[model samples]
Target: MAPLTSASDENTHQTLLNTLDIYSAPKPFRNASWKPPQRRNKNTKAILADAARKESSQVTTANSGTSTPAADTAPPNIAQAAQRLDRLVLEKSLIAPGPAVTYTNIEAAPSLRPERTRHYCDVTGLVAPYTDPKTRLRYHNVEVFNLIRTMGSAATEGYLEARGAHTVLK
Candidate 1:
């Protein structure tokens, strides 16, 4: 059997590196004839003019004291109409006397509350068996406990804040 030659090995290595370099480089943009469609300017102008004419005619009829069904039935503003509708609904509900079930009433039910709280490690997101009393942080093992112990007060507070247990002052 013939011994492996360095020249052929170097050439193969160089070819592999060149292939990797080609694959790593970004691909070139495609040469395409794509273009956006042109707008119908004349048709748009004619439609706008027709809309303006209709609006002007409506204004003239309104100014001449001719009452249309739409003008008579619709309110001046949408917000005021919504408020009036809300008031009517409230008045109707109050007059008819029914069960007044609310969000707070449902939440106050004993069955809705959890029986026991679940404790989880703040760092590893695992079930915590021990808690550090000083920082009040739950940990899975000594490693997480050591991590929490070495953290600064601000970092500890940040971790607590993420879990919605950080103390707040007014």
Candidate 2:
């Protein structure tokens, strides 16, 4: 039996050339006459300064407890409105507010955790039997363990971090 050669395969070469030709062909312009939107001639800094002036005037009038009809009707910024709502809620005892929910609090309890922790080798991505004490990197065999032992501190930390086992100090 003769071994099939790539150079002798005229059909495969022609197919590849045809594929390249199809890709290299000029694509049609979807929006040939399209133009970018025109920009405003206004100065951003001046606009910002004007807005700041208006905000400051409103704040001053509100703080003095002599807000005009226009100032009183204007909606408050999100942070200011949220603070006001919080204060109102606290004053009226609307809801029985408790401790803030966080990642640490929401995580599964120790009693609900799996009995056997699965360990995997960072290098091989296989079931690891041994863990290096210094680097805390799990290894499948002596060869992987030896590789981890010879790695620099940065490389060792990187391997541990990739597996989410790197120890962080305060």
**Model 1 C-alpha lDDT per residue in residues 65-161, reported as the tens digit of each score:** 3222245566788898887678666755554354333333443336666677778998899999898999999899998999999999999899899
lDDT winner: 1
Estimate the lDDT of model 1. Answer: 0.72
Model 2 lDDT on a 0 to 1 scale: 0.70
TM-score of 1: 0.34
Candidate with the greatest TM-score versus the true structure: 1
The lDDT for every candidate, in the order shown, is 0.72, 0.70
**Model 1 alpha-carbon drift over 4 Å, by segment:** 1-114
Task: Give the 10-residue window scoring lowest on summed lDDT in candidate 1.
Answer: 99-108
